[model samples]
Target: MTAAHRKIIHIDMDAFYASVEQLDFPELRNKPLAVGGSEIRGVISAASYEARKFGVRSAMSGKLAIKKCPELIFVKPRFDRYKEVSQQIRAIFLEYTDLVEPLSLDEAFLDVTINKKNLKSATNIAEEIRRKIFETTGLTASAGISVNKFLAKIASDYNKPNGQKTIRPEEIIPFLDALEIKRFFGVGKKTCEKMYHLGIFTGSDLRMKSIDFLEEHFGNSGLHFYQLARGISNSPVVPNRLPKSIGAERTFTENFTSIIPLQDKLKDVCEEVSIRLQKRNLSGKTLTLKIKYSDFTLQTKSTTLPYYISSYDLLLDTALDLLANSDLKTSVRLIGIQISNLNINQKKAEYVQLKFRF
Candidate 1:
């Protein structure tokens, strides 16, 4: 019901960070560039289209990336500049519709079914937004238009880098049927292998199987596969879907049994969470500590404070106390710290001096 007769558009910026770098430094345009540190232990945050030609990609180790392209230029990320551009893009989206769901700093979903511009064609809106992005930020964005969010998102990737794709309702079935199983939204490497072994290589093959059979083979995920194969997705385009919680987690190569080592890990997790909160301009009243034993069993403990907190020291202290009071019968392989009940629009007066137990 949520997907019926709806018009959704997904807009994704082309090589956002790298593109921004190129825009700021005109000499870098049309050249191989990556945004990240060039340290031995560093990884690429983003790569320019030129660098991508040599198989250089974001998240790859700097050493490996440089091996692929010796001419790759590394530039440190300037998040503040990216945020400013994101705000500008969001402003353009709000001019046409209030139903804008941002996926990240450089991607978003816009529901223009009943927009302020009274536009009938979602494709037209997508083009206008793409044009505006280029004009305002000097960056190109690709777009996908369809009846639902799932289809729209996938279609957006069909034509990369300044292109747009539209999947009409009538064409959805054939489009999906021809699509490889690996291209489905939730199908990863393992899932693809499983599907291949089960003789399901494409959407058409998946469509031939009964929901019961698929579910029995893939567990709950089979239901999603079954629906997707039929081009049936009813997910909504939710607006202003702020994160419920913010957290940082780490899994150790070696399990830890001692309280001292675990406490040190907690400090790192808490610091990461605090940094994320500050970047988002958020504060939270609840603190949660999570632990995963070497055997994969998970346990979590949480407490609420009387006032919002965003300080690194406070978060670290609270997380450490939570760890101290936790059930530590087994060695932990993974640990995390999270904060919930966030106030994205927090005021200075919201902070209070109150000591609460973890």
Candidate 2:
């Protein structure tokens, strides 16, 4: 359908990992709980709402999280359980529309313009989906309904924790105008700082800038900002989207200065990546090695091979070579390896534009 008339819904589970842990463990309910971290080392994968009140957040170091909330309880991640719940939620989405794009285990976008139920109201469909999710999995979900994926995704976060919001086409302009520049998708902290320096703090400020002006200052992303400020997004929701890359990494409990231990870690990471590639029946021509120093500085080295390879031995050899040629500026805190430029047969999905009266 036409970009302006498409019915998109973004569903995001509230504190997914932490919520799941609470649901499974009665003692964790209504407590400051964190998933996938420890008091000594590692990063938090998710933090419960209670923990969030204490300034605990996902990606925060476990040590810092513990300091922020001394009573915080940590739990290891259960990926298999999360996967099972995700499947159940996916089934619920498929019941209404096949045009579902899963962003992750806990969030997805559903295009219900031409749904299986032939539903006329996207908002109603979203509510039903949320209700069904709670009934089926005993988990609360929030939803955003809008004309396109970007608006829908943003609306989803407006009323979180088992709430839903709908942004009709008529409200699109004003909704985006008053929105904070930092809330715009793809605008990170660095970009926000740059925009702030330019006196662009909101979408309204962004809309006042010309494409040429934006492009001169922000490069190609300037055009993106200009379009987004005007409530324009044409990106479609693609189902069963193929991943662009596959990789694995690990953070050391203690920074390592020796090459032997770093090499051993790289080998383990390569093995993990190789296994993942094999599981997906995928291989890539490009390999990248990522290193994070003790000072939190990051470096990456990449090499493209003539042939695609997913073998563990090949990956280890290439990664080891990359590591050997790299400078060890400081003790290493984290290391990662990724394979991109994957070999996959891709088919373009065709879309027909049709304007809808909302």
10 residues in a row with least lDDT, candidate 1? 348-357
Which parts of model 1 are misplaced by more than 4 Å? 37-39, 248-272, 275-314, 321-337, 340-353, 356-358
TM-score, candidate 1, is: 0.79
User: Where does candidate 1 clash, by residue pair?
Assistant: none
Residue 52 Cα positional deviation in candidate 1, in Å, after optimal superposition:
1.3
User: What shift in Å separates residue 348 of candidate 1 from its native position after superposition?
Assistant: 19
Candidate 2: count the clashes: 1
lDDT of 1 by residue, 54-167 (tens): 999997877789899999898989999999999999999999999999989999999999999998999999999999989998899999999988889889989998999999
Give the alpha-carbon lDDT of every model.
0.89, 0.92
The superposed Cα distance between candidate 2 and the true structure at residue 112, in angstroms, equals: 0.1
- Compose the digit string of candidate 2's lDDT tens values, residues 1-358: 5898899999999999999999999989999999987998888999999999999999998999999999999999999999999999999999998899999999999999999998899999999999999999999999999999999999999999899999998998899889999999888999999999999999899999999999999998888888999889999999999999999999998999988999999988999999999999888889999999987789999999877778888888889999999999999999999999888763432222332323
